[model samples]
Target: MVSRQNIIRVADFIDSTTRSWRTELILNTFSKDDAQKILQIPLTHIPHDGFLV
Candidate 1:
């Protein structure tokens, strides 16, 4: 799980980069099995303007 502090750090980093940057943070919970499946998939399979934590 991404902690609140870590999320804040990421947001701060993004803000420091450029004020014009558009940012969105999402939090989701998944079962252990589902999470394992997700981890097994290559990141290239996921699409987004930003990145996954």
Candidate 2:
């Protein structure tokens, strides 16, 4: 399984890219039960560019 810090890092990347604070809130408060849902997201879809890498 991926680490929580890694997930938060992705969330931070998304928040930065979209300038959306909602990502921060979700990352900050996400529960263990929600992790599977987050994992379903394709991190690669954001591109391997520096922004989301």
Could you tell me which 10 consecutive residues in candidate 2 have the lowest summed lDDT?
Answer: 44-53
Clashing pairs in 2: none
- TM-score per model over all chains: 0.30, 0.29
Clashes of 1: 0
| Top lDDT hit | 2
What would the per-residue lDDT of candidate 1 be over residues 1-53, giving only the tens digit for each residue? 44445655433323333432122322143456665554454333333366676
Whole-model lDDT per candidate: 0.39, 0.50
Runs of candidate 2 exceeding 4 Å displacement: 1-29, 45-53
Q: What is candidate 2's local distance difference test score?
A: 0.50
